[model samples]
Target: MEKGIIFDIRHFSTHDGPGIRTTVFFKGCPLRCIWCHNPESQKLEPEAINRTKKLDGQEFEVKEILGRYISTDEVIKEIETQVSIFDESNGGVTFSGGEPLMQPRFLLELLKRCREHDIHTAVDTCGFAAPELFRSILPYTNLFLYDLKIIKSDKHKYYTAQPNEIILNNLSMLNQLGASVMVRVPLIPGITDDEENLLAIKEIVKGNNSIKRLDLLPYHHMAKDKYRRLNLPFELEDLEAYKNERLKEIELMFSDLEMPISIGG
Candidate 1:
């Protein structure tokens, strides 16, 4: 039996992809983005998201949680229970992560099984995984909520502790594949809200017809407290959600780009 380390699983989420979704948040990530909301999912540092997790119909956690390895059959069975809901809502399952691609094989099999069950699938990724890994699984993905942290190389590294190489490459591949994609950029007040980053993102999206929508997720400090809970230092404590007007300005700027401007999920 294969069991992948998991931290959280959210159900009936209408935001990630189309319709209602069951988001499977896998544990582990490659980049250390300061503004990461799911700090618990940011590391392979799996133990338990909650020593006493409440398991109900809507939210299900495996009874015997272990290491990052999980059986593919078991996961598909859990997903199958939601098929009726998925069918009604036209929403499927989303394999989110600590960077879902971090466990490439696990994610691939997960996605493959979802497809076999005739479910719509989406991958909420930081867009930082290896190119080959991305190519192999994307064929099974119905939609992608690809995150755009920073466009400039140096700025991106400073913010996420990683380069934009693989990230951008994966985005490009998504464009090339004609895959349904929505570009999600965190509306950080100082770091990501700059003219350069916004403009660069604009250029990239404008150049690709594959992208037709942009979702701006405003920054929040709600996740800061998690760092304290987990004994991890909060790196983005200084940042707050961008002002309403500033966020509107961003939306207005992209409004001219001829895309649907979804403010939030």
Candidate 2:
């Protein structure tokens, strides 16, 4: 009975991976990126949160619990219920985080079970785990939604609260092993979207064929409300979501790459 803490299990998700899918968001993370959208997913334990609800014109306060420990069998049952939908849409389950690799044993078990069910699997990771962790899960994972934030070591450390050495090394290892990787870059306004950082990322994936597509994720302030609910400060409260025109220009930067470039997720 292997159990892992999970904060969310989102169904019919189009942005996580191919077709329609279910994204199983594992709780706990190594890197504490300032612009984290799912601030609730950062901690490993269950969190009792105070939230506000409105009916008609009146406001009411409510209590909600965030993360919970669930058995692998239980999680598999939930995934099995969506198999029909998965089959019809070429969709399957995606294990995402607060860095799923943080719980290696539990994650490995889920991946093995998903494999046993003949389900297409993807791991949305920050690439901050031990190299061996990636190697162990490589066989079970069909695709990887890898996040590559700041490339400069100092800035990467300053922003993510974790050095990029392990992350970069793990990515290089994956590339060497010919893993199917879709590099996702979170375009945080001044931090990650700078010309220098973007260009540095371009250099990393320049010649890699195993690296599939590039997803340029522009920052948005939608999570401010979530932060408010959790009583956490929204660091980028004043930052606006990127406009279409600027996003297009940034998209054009990677226009010549062999792999396709998408603007979101």
Candidate 3:
């Protein structure tokens, strides 16, 4: 049996994608976004020993606890547990991650199985993967939740440790290829919410009709507590969250665009 490292399986999740959906959060990420909420998902490692203590009130030097990666057959069985919920809610399955494309082979297999059952499939990605990876997976996808960070090369690198070259390239290719994609912008207060960067994002994606809709996710310090539990320091320390009114104001720049913009992701 093949297995993939997934840190979370969130059911009845609406924000990750369209409709009511189950979000399968895979482990490992290439970029280091200082505002990341799920810090654990960024690492290939399972939860550390000390972190387990806080979750379960026990302490240990090392914790190799097995994670839940349900079998292909079991996926539908579990998904059925909420089938009525999905039907009523107009939702399906979303493959999210540290970066789902990070585990391309496994994700491809899982998505194949999901499609055989006619489940709607969506991928939430950082657009920081190899072009071939995106090419291989696009066919299996129904919708894409593509995340674009800073537009300037240096600022994008400083915040995510990756230049925006490949990121922009992949997005452009996806658009040309006619993928049904939605652009997600994490409006981190001091970093992403800067008017300059936000305008840059608008200009970068404005012409691409394939990614007509935009979802602005407000940044919060909620991940700080998680970082502390894992003995990791959050680099975006002390960054203020962008206020809701501010997010609405920023959304106005894209007002001329045809598709509607919604705040919160």
Model 1 has an lDDT value of 0.80
Per-residue lDDT of 1-265 in model 3, one digit per residue for the tens? 3477887788989898878999888888999887888777787656543453443766544444324455555655677677777778878898888898888888888788778777888999999999999899888899999998899999899989899899899999998999999999988877787888888888877878789588988876677766766667777677777666787788887788778788887
Clashing pairs in 3: 20-91
Better of 1 and 2 by TM-score: 2
Candidate 1's residue-wise lDDT over 1-265, tens digit each?
4457676677899988889989888888889888787776776854553322334645343333323555778678778888899999999999887898888888888888888888999999998877888789878988888898888888899888898988888889888888888889888778888888889998998998778688988887677665654555787776666667877888887888777878875
Q: How many residue pairs clash in all the candidates, one count each?
A: 9, 0, 1
Top of the candidates by lDDT: 2
C-alpha positional error of residue 264 in candidate 3 after TM-score superposition, expressed in Å: 0.8
By TM-score, the best candidate is 2
Q: Model 2 scores what on Cα lDDT?
A: 0.90
Pairwise lDDT winner, candidates 1 and 3: 3
Query: Local error of candidate 2 at 196, Å?
Result: 0.5
Give the TM-score of each candidate: 0.88, 0.97, 0.90
- lDDT, model 1, position 93: 93
Model 1 spans with C-alpha error above 4 angstroms: 47-69
How many backbone collisions does model 1 have? Answer: 9
All candidates: CA RMSD in angstroms? 4.9, 1.1, 2.8
